[model samples]
Target chain A: MTAPSAVGISRTTRPLAPPRRTRRGSRLRYTLTVLAFLLPSALPLLAFTIYPMIGAFWTSLHSWNLIGVMEWVGLENYTTLLTDDATRRVFANTLYYVVGYLPLVYIGGLALALALNSLIPARNLLRGIYFLPVVTSWIVVALVWRWLLNPSVGVVNAMLGGLGIDGPGWWTDPYWAMPSIILASAWKDLGFVMIILLAGLQAIPTDVQEAAMIDGAGRFRRLLNITLPLLSPSTFFVVVISLINGFQVFDQVYAMTGGGPAGSSTVVVQQIYDLTFRYSSAGEASALSWLLFLLVLAVTVIQLIGQRRWVTYA
Target chain B: MPERIRRILLTAVVALGALVMFFPFAWTVSTSLSPGVGLDATPQLIPDDPTLAAYRELFANTPFARVIANSLGLAITTTALQLTTSSLAGYAFSRLAFPGRGLVFGLYLATMMIPIQVLIVPLFVQMRSLGLVDTYLGVLLPGVASAFGVFLLRQAMNSVPRELDEAATIDGAGHFRIFARLVLPLVGPALASLAVFAFMSSWNGFLWPLIILRSEHLQTLPLALAGLQGQYTTQWDVMMAGSVVSVLPMLALYLFAQKYVIQGVAGTGLK
Candidate 1:
């Protein structure tokens, strides 16, 4: 992609300058060239990403709605959101979603990936099948799951009735709504995690496994000792991505429950959306969004710190 | 004898797992074909009397066709622009020895780490100010210069040898000529993979489109599908039919290019 003559241009341009040392001149030219390459991307990043983030932090300090005159609250928004009962409940619900979602997706995805990695004849087809939902939009998946999990005319309840067992109102009932969202999210996400794990499995050298086999190691022993250790990097990637995605769980919850059934499934993102767009409480929404940002930042830093011990890349 | 039995059991287990993984899709197809009330009773494995009424209803009542068209247009346009911009920037980063290169690239990748939610408000405000809100350009603008695309393409471009550029230059090719004639053709596979990822992401995108596209005619498939669910009120057969329409193209693309897609994602070291 690089033109060999471009370096010649740099040399010729430098020679055209005064015979004295042109180190400072070349540095200036280099800086301009870098800016030319970065300007398009940097413009958006500044306008959309960084500026808004700082603006959110600033807005969170005040109490302002869409039309009201700005009233400087001085941390009242944060303090109120931190201590309010509804805010506490919403935070608790978000925790419920994370706790419910992470393990199911992580362990379930790992098991599926492992199972598919075994000596299955149609492994490619199976992998494709498992990964199908990953590429589909979550809205479609959520809609379909809502139908299947419907209490009265749904297939799940129908099957339950056939088995002489009663199925609860999956989306309507308070207790089951969050679990239903978790199951739907897991179904949509499992394929992505499995694909990552399968790639990790394929990267594991065959000689390592063969040597273990020659030493009379059984299937389970080799899996425990050799395979698992080599797969840690991919596992770590899956965990990090899944956790970030789980915490940002908005689309499915929005479509499936709308944070209804008495706000049982009201995740932090939904709260932010409701506050900003629905209620026009931009200040509070900004506060809540900043809170989520900090939480995610803290988690990501912890993961990066933790990665030193586990993640191996060549 | 025990080993032989164990092998058979393993086969059974794998088959069962595959079956369960595929069950929801299969059930969706079956339920779409089945007559009304068939989906509610005992969840029949096979439809007793199949009909195309749901498909008919889907086409007749809603703007399903328009939604499909909008999604295709958005996905294709966004992917094309993304590939062009990212390829240019990626080539520059990999081949050009500009100053502040490290800091610039770092800033680009840093944008990837920030959750897109943090940017929504300003982006919306910016779009509103530009009078681009509720337009196709609005959906396509933010994604055209994607950081992940730049990152992936740069990785691929770095592997391309410098000799190719020198040969083209010696043959009297200019910089743009070398880029188009020599560089781009060599990185065809990488470009194709990036295109696939971009297309899938744009096609499956819901949140941005939902927030931006207010007009009914411009609504994408996912948005349209969500609307169908509410308007129909327990008409799943029709909803499933709409979903099938939405998903079929993606399925076809994925099946045909499964190898490239897998290689592309794996190439990113995302695994």
Candidate 2:
């Protein structure tokens, strides 16, 4: 950010520089060199991201069981998946997880950011401790939480017992299974959200808050009027990222519950996995993925537009 | 209400929250060390009689050693490939002014928004067609290029002084020589950050490896650990041991390069 503008200023001021486009031989050499630099990455990205994206859509229109040749059954997969009761339930489950996850994570993240931003001893160590989960793999985290939330002999229930209350059967109970996953997910992401929000917090000018303080603004009022408004862009960033990730919550659910206890915690990506690998319904899986993509794109676009109303840029 | 009193209160609150974050990890280590067949009815922050029995069983009873080797090998390869590809492309985008550069770069960035789930089925098919399924190549091929890494490095490379490149050009150094000798050294920190991110993501990757790697001998640490959790449903000690082993490398990496990891994550969000 600092370099490009400085270079622009220097270019305008210094007039004796040689023009870049004049030499035919050098231009050809430059083009070849750029191609050489680009092709290594460009090839894999094309084969994986670009080609498979188009191929995913094309496969969604056909029926294949991964062993046989793809049979053309255009739109049938989409039509069936769209109307299936199980599909609706799984999509609804994903939404439920996102609804619970997004707010919990953001609020927790913001709270942590605010506390860490204040005058505190060992702030750096505290920040690293909170971020520990973010660096750990989802499988490990889910496994640990599964043990932690085990209904029979888990620490959480024991802690509750000490408090004279009974802890619910977390991942084991069908009713509480999704909530259990939400808790684990939110716990893992709090540090990520904290780091982003802390960066935003530090970016806010101190003079603004001091100015408010001189004007007799209390702590809460300054937080509302001066701080949060300046922090909106980071807040928007965390929300959009958390929302996109929430829609694709799989590893934890897979490891924790396996969408279990009557498929209560079954999510969209898990459904995609089940449809493709378990059921051998590759076409439906591809169709379901497309549906997920559309949902993410729609939600992200809406958030982008909505940010204009609430997100303050300074 | 007093300044010192308020500071103490704030410190206490933050410390409590930090404990909540760190407790799971502390318990995992404690449980792994505890000598028992399964979990106790009550939680124990410290085991009464700790032993290395679980870790011993984790290695003896399972293919954990092989799993770690597989994960380490794949992550190292993935990180190396990502650094080469992303740095080369990033330098080109930042320095060389080619036709349709903006459009191509924009396409790369757009691809970043599409989650990997969308490409899984077709990518599996493509790999199977190439006769590479259940092989290491299949697991590593799709992830060799990263759009996020490219963007991060481009931002880093963009900040390098152009006047240095101009002087190098005047001295008749070609683009490759200048890229190798001049620009790359200046962007070492960004490259380190990219390396860290690439290694961590590959180390933690589950879905692709689950689908592609089928053999017991070829599974990554996460895949094997999940398999262990399923195969030994009641063995909490063993499971915790596996979790600890899988997490230790990442813990070490984060501690060793703490700045790059945090900076890389924060840099992406802020930008």
Candidate 3:
């Protein structure tokens, strides 16, 4: 955009400023150039993301399906979502999922990162092996897990049977369903979390570790004092990103259980999907989306506020 | 504990960890290859009666071939469109100094925080209004403008030397020429990484396409696979075969370009 302004400069200093008209013209050209580059992204995003965002908020206020006359129902959708038992179950299930999933991911990711950072052979191969699941589609992953965890003929049950133990129905059991999905999710995302944390770990200066060692610091003491503190930024990144993603958890749950076992596994996004597309309740769906969005935003804001305590850049 | 024992223990743990991570994928591949194995039977990791029967069954049962084609075409188009817009926007944000630049860039970044699921209802509603539902464009349009890609490439373009663009300008080349000839080539690796990510994301995208694409033939691989899963619930081998068919290309692509993909995410976190 500023390319045209190159014409305005002179090293000789033989003349004063260029014509005000030409200067203004270059600015105009620069503005046009900027817009020209931006339009391709801006136009589609405005149409698809931005416009729909405002539309979602507006639609949340009205009982509108894709067809028929729209009826205004201010706050009713929100009120019902808050008050309804079914929606409450969905909300609580989402909470349980976040509660169950995040800790596993953080602990598992940190453990993997620490282990790999300390010592392991064939590092890239191990990293690839760990990362394999992240590449596979959630549909495939869910189906595979469903087959693995089936009560009657599943491999997991067969192994339990070998030990003279009765295995619970994983996805079909109301109590274990969310936990099972959480486990699968934890497995699916472990690689990404590990990679991020490992990157953070590797970036630590070895001299710091050696300095602690020379000072007769125990391995545990060094890790607690130095490694963990320095690793917090990556940990913070993984936690926030995964938590936001956790709120939107749908693909695996939908593909595996369809939020079944009497809605024990329904997350917020799945509820939104069912409400909008299946039941043609666009207003309710929009309300649920906004609710989910607010939840994610809140969690992100909290994390951002919390990060300064431990997430040291240096 | 001595260093040697510690190393061995760590190695064993890592091996076990990798096994835990990879076992599901191996099971899927094994099951897909070992057709007609019942869930009740003790599953064999390597079947005695290995066959392509499940694949044949998958092909016979669904228009999976067409589904794959639909997915391939949609993913490519989406990637191409995203790369174009992202690179252009990245160039502009990085190189050009214009009024309201920070505001515009901030707006774009804000949209990234809003989950794609949150936009599904209204986005679909908008598409339905425009009669884009059930069309390729309907599915493709929603994924085209990527905030991550723009931000990543902006960082990349910032790393690129401004001297090249200035030199080109001194030779009477315009901004477009500088962008096209000088800036874009320098950011080639970043674009490559962006392409891989965009392709992976569009390929794995389920929610929007499931809502938009109505026809069985128009459905992408994920949607089609979900449909097949609903139909053939207990037919593990057949479903796994279909999963394999859907997953193989991505697996190949990922293994081929693992460094770039990992680097992309790491670079973002570092920034």
Candidate 4:
């Protein structure tokens, strides 16, 4: 009953079909109805996602700009990106982002979750206040941070100046630009992680904490041994997500640094944008895009494999 | 005695953290209201002389009003499209007897794993070939078909009792009849949850829209805000005014539907 599919449909084959056989004359109608429902998503998904995935590979092998003649240059794009010093620095900058970005989000989110989990007045209000940033678009977040960190007349440096300390030029200074983006990114996203962790915290039964308390475990000890161990699954979830997001960071860098005062904050996606649109290097950009995808895929695969050692599912 | 002191310290720390979280936004609003006195050290939080001159100038200088309308129209269109398609695909996956169900769904979920960064250039080529560049249709198409939304709805649809659909089938009711009548009504809560997510993502989506929408008048809030920032790099007051305008609707929506939004997020992320 399975025909060779032209489009990207599921090639599901049962050795002996039951439903189609039973339906008989109405089988075609049933299939049609299913296709009707499926086609809406399937066509667009194939067009937008599946088609482009294949096209990405094909395009990566050709030296083509948007308007110019397409020339076959398989592996050259990859070679250029891998060997070029500038592109190498772009990869390093991406690594720097993930390295600096994830920890701040995890630590800050966990701390906020832990704090909110405890007895507190205006708890929901406080949670809402904390979550306010999460919903704000990254463009807005980047703009806000740019203003706040604008050295000459910004609020942050002004506060630092008031404290009798000179503040460094945040987004302008190559050294501080990435760290500044990390802080802003973490702040904007920490609320989502906090909410997820808070859900985990809530799921941990109060009796477990009580049992630990009655067994002569102090607050810190309980948190270290019992609380954190139980919170592993959620923590693992948050970490994986944080890493993925941290690696693919584009908006903040695009808005705040524009790959910046000597390319300090140039993340991979930013480079891809610059390559594709600015430099009109579609083939090289696609290659870079795939490499970024590979890095994310590799990291995620590694996390999945490694989580077996530490992440307790139950 | 120490426990009390610990609570006090924890409370103080959390409060300070909240201030840090909120200070930028508060200052944005404050700045948006204040006229451009030009840049100076230690800008006033209360803006001793508050004015809406920045807000006025934001509208007067650019197509800020048209940008807002564009954002609203696109967000609503994308949300509607996603909901309909996701719910339909979700229903077929959950209730229908289909071959390769496992394989197809697996492929669909894997798309979620791939970051959108990978798709930008090739997707752009496809759009350009289709002659849809710099159009709302191009911006709306990519986001409207979401695999995660389908997966979420399928799970929601699974909890729906099969007996009801079976009875309907026995009553000679078709898939559409059962789906449109029985299944959808039962899955209202799930639909609502997905709507909030779909709406927010479309509204806040920056990268794809920024790539596709080249024209200024076609720009959504996020893109317009980006353009606005590019134009007025040093006009903190007007930029803040635009920032305030862009962020307020979302903040209000989240507050209005706080429980649904949070629960929706928690459900998706935890799963």
TM-score of chain A of each: 0.88, 0.92, 0.91, 0.92
> Model 1 off-target regions past 4 Å?
A1-40, A67-71, A312-314, B1-4, B38-43, B269-271
lDDT of 1 at A235: 85
Q: Clashes in each model (backbone N, CA, C under 3 Å)?
A: 0, 0, 0, 1
lDDT string, candidate 1, A197-240, tens digits? 87888889999899999999998999888988888888888777
Q: In model 2, where do residues sit more than 4 Å from their true spots?
A: A1-26
Candidate 2 residues A79-137, lDDT tens each? 99988999999999999999999889999999999999988999999999999899899
lDDT of 4 at A143: 92
Docking verdict class for candidate 4: medium
lDDT of 3 by residue, B51-140 (tens): 888999999879999999998998899899999999999988887665466899999999999888999988887888889999998898
Order the candidates by DockQ, highest first — what do you get? 2, 4, 3, 1
| Residues A1-314 of candidate 4: C-alpha lDDT, one tens digit per residue | 55323222323423112243344456676677778888899888888898898888888999998788889997999999999997889889988988988888889899999999999877898899888888888899999899888888988888899899999999999999998998888889888999999998888888989988999998789999988988888998888888888888898898898889789889889999999999999999999988888888998899999998887655
Q: Which residue pairs collide, candidate 2?
A: none
Window of ten residues with lowest summed lDDT in model 2 chain B: B35-44
Task: TM-score each candidate.
Answer: 0.91, 0.96, 0.95, 0.95
All candidates' lDDT scores? 0.79, 0.90, 0.85, 0.85
Tens digit per residue, CA lDDT, model 3, A221-241: 999999998887887888888
- Quote the lDDT for B49 in model 1: 85
Give per-residue lDDT, candidate 1, residue B55. Answer: 93
lDDT of residue B86 for candidate 3: 98
Stretches of model 3 off by over 4 angstroms after superposition: A1-27
